[model samples]
Target: MSDIAAPRSSSRARNLKGGGRNRSGQTNFELYSWLFMRLSGLALVVLVLGHLFTNLMLGDGINGLDFAFVAGKWASPLWQVWDLLMLWLAMLHGTNGMRTIINDYAEKDQTRFWLKALLLTASIVIVVLGTLVIFTFDPCLDPHSTLSVCQ
Candidate 1:
């Protein structure tokens, strides 16, 4: 039998030459968002694992986790800031990933715009509320927990 060459993928060949070029110049937003996703994901790996290790492994494990534990953690400004960073990074990372999905799948321009707007608004609210809770939390609020150290 005569040797034959493998068939090539014409679609991929065309795409390699910028076959999908759009009607406008490319924006850097997607590039930056993609980079952010990778970097934030990496940082989250460390932050989340460290948090788990401290709260669940370094101490009495899960049994040590309670309202008082949380209060005690938050009482230290360092831990509070760490939690705040985690909250912001997670929300932003997840929201950006969702935005990429919506941009990919949404058909109508108006629909995409509205959905993204809502997502942004909700993210903002949650981030603000979570940050406020972290900084403004009072461990002495509960009457039954008067023996707590914060009281």
Candidate 2:
């Protein structure tokens, strides 16, 4: 290997001198997003693994998962809150992650805006629906329904 090897250079290496505000006028939003990604990713690992373990390991495992089974779990406040927390955290984390990816790759402003708009819509829809399912679920509904635990 040569002593210098032509020296390495990248966008971050060159400081933007008088470029506007960032030296290159780069907004701190990207930096904040990067930090959020790391923190959220770490949390997601724990939340997801715990979820999988509880739902697929303890007792009958995956074989036990079903509509009635879900209703029974949701009948308890603990599982309800647990699932609510999991839903919100994972949704926000995933949305922010996708935002980062979009910002990093999208070239045009309109393209970036549209992609983010779609991501936000989908995230919000899922989060709201998931939260509703966790909270408004009536385990006692339909006494004759075979699928309901209340039956």
What are the models' TM-scores? Answer: 0.73, 0.71
User: Model 2: what TM-score?
Assistant: 0.71
Residue lDDT tens for model 1, 10-46: 5445545564442243445677888999999999998
The predictions' CA RMSDs to the true structure, in order, are 11.8, 10.9
Which residues of candidate 1, in runs, are more than 4 Å off? 1-26, 58-63
Clashes of each: 0, 2
lDDT of 2 by residue, 1-151 (tens): 5675544444435544433336554766667767877887788788789889988999799899977788877878887877887788788878997988998999999999999999999999999999887778886676677764554
Error of 1 at 2 (Å): 71
